[model samples]
Target: MPKAKKSQAKPKTKKAPQKLRQQVAALPVRLSEGGQIEVLLVTSRDSRRWIIPKGWPMKGKKRHEAAAIEAEEEAGVLGTIQDKALGHYRYSKQQADGREIGCRVAVYALNVTEELADWAEKGQRQMQWVRSEIAADLVQEPELSLLLRKIGPP
Candidate 1:
């Protein structure tokens, strides 16, 4: 009897890490004065780095709606979305409990009409408005900078 031929199989592709499944939302807002496209940045709760006004999406809300809400809560700004998405980016966040989780953020452009210094109600660390180009440079994640560039300055 002849020996059976040996079988071969291809290797499977590795999946992305589950720790990379976090979702967040950001908004690109412009000042009404100089018509300059500006971004609202916030300090992390741990004071680690400066970043955009973004957070986990609330249950039962669309991504863009969550982006708008995070903008209002973190930066104390009220605005209307332009019905457009700026882009997306990914990064890592360290929670207060010492857990580091990867995060993905969806960005949107908003036409801001007001600014209030009342972020305490939402438990934000700090907020500031910077020129879009400058703001893009300030973010720690390279993907976010690229997204900002794609959105362009107002």
Candidate 2:
């Protein structure tokens, strides 16, 4: 029998969470007619988890501006995004190869000015405008939950 050749697969290396990848999230909010704090959340593309609009860094744009871009693409929100970040949260993001990467998200408040009748991701995901307290409860990430709960009406 001929000897089998060695496999060419590369060894897997684990990335350190301490050097967590940076991400930006848009916390789209608006005051309801009742003067209550209502936050906009969109379902994740694959997992369908309740999450704020977030994405990787954008070229040339500032962090918060990139976050605003994510909000527009994911939730159909047009608004004023605060220059300062409200807070940060860490979560494990599932990768294509069944690995979870650590992501540190800077949350920026977006005071919604207009919600489009139709936006980029209108049909792929479900968007909801719920009370801030309710948003805190719906998210699975504990740190995100705390962040949302602590965020006052803006």
Candidate 3:
């Protein structure tokens, strides 16, 4: 009797896990006429979901400074930003190749002092200043919503 031929199969290789990318965000805010705290939110470029101004770390810039710059460019707002981060939130960003990468964003409080009528990304997004409670309800990120709910008098 002839011996049975051995099966031939290639071994599966595991793909390397992607590292979590670091990002910074500015929680722009101001006081309403009734002395209630309000937050400034901008519509995301792709999904149009409400979000705070955020971006990747800028070269040679501190984390808080980068957050402030993102607020100006994305939301057309500028203000005094706290150097320390208020909190952090995790989210997944879709890349051009359709792969999702995990991102961790450090949020800093920005006391909005100036809002420009014309600025970068002006027409690309819609912005609103809502009471913190309402702002919490508007955002889709649960962690961000919790941060909004925790905001109190400055």
Candidate 4:
């Protein structure tokens, strides 16, 4: 009987981990007449999901500043933006080509003082002001929901 031939198999190679893209977002907020925290949410252009205003970093602007700019453009709100980040959340963004990219967003709290009647994204998106607790329920991101919950009155 001929000796059995040894099997030769190719070594398995691990795929490289996808890099997480960095972004800045603003959590627009205001105090209701009853002194309750109200969060301003904007509908995403493509999916129409409720999400905070976010985008890539802008030139000659700090992280928080860029976040504020995004808020103005996407949500049509303006106010004092905090320098420090409230927290960060990770999400997968779907691209036009059907690829999902990993992203990490640094959230800054923006106390909205003014809302524009006609803004860049006014017609493109719907804006809503809801109680913090309700806003938490309205959003899709878990970490962002937790952040919204933290801003509610004790």
Output the number of the lDDT-best candidate. 2
Model 1: per-residue Cα lDDT over 1-154, one tens digit each? 9999878777788986666664656665775377767777777667647777777778998777887787777677777865456777888777789977887777777667777756544564756778777877887899988776666544
How does residue 17 of candidate 3 score in lDDT? 78
Task: Residues 90-148, candidate 2: write the lDDT tens digits.
Answer: 99999989988889999999999988888888899988999989999999999999998
Distance from true position, residue 146, model 4, in Å?
A: 1.5
For candidate 3, the lDDT comes to: 0.93
lDDT of 2: 0.93
* TM-scores of all predicted structures: 0.76, 0.88, 0.88, 0.91
lDDT, candidate 3, 1-154, per-residue tens: 9999999888888988778899999999999899999999999998899999999999999999999999999998888999999999888988888988999999999999999888889899989999999999999989999999998775
* Deviation from truth (RMSD, Å), model 3: 2.9
Model 4 ranges with Cα > 4 A deviation:
1-8, 152-154
Error of 2 at 96 (Å): 1.3
lDDT per model vs. reference:
0.72, 0.93, 0.93, 0.91
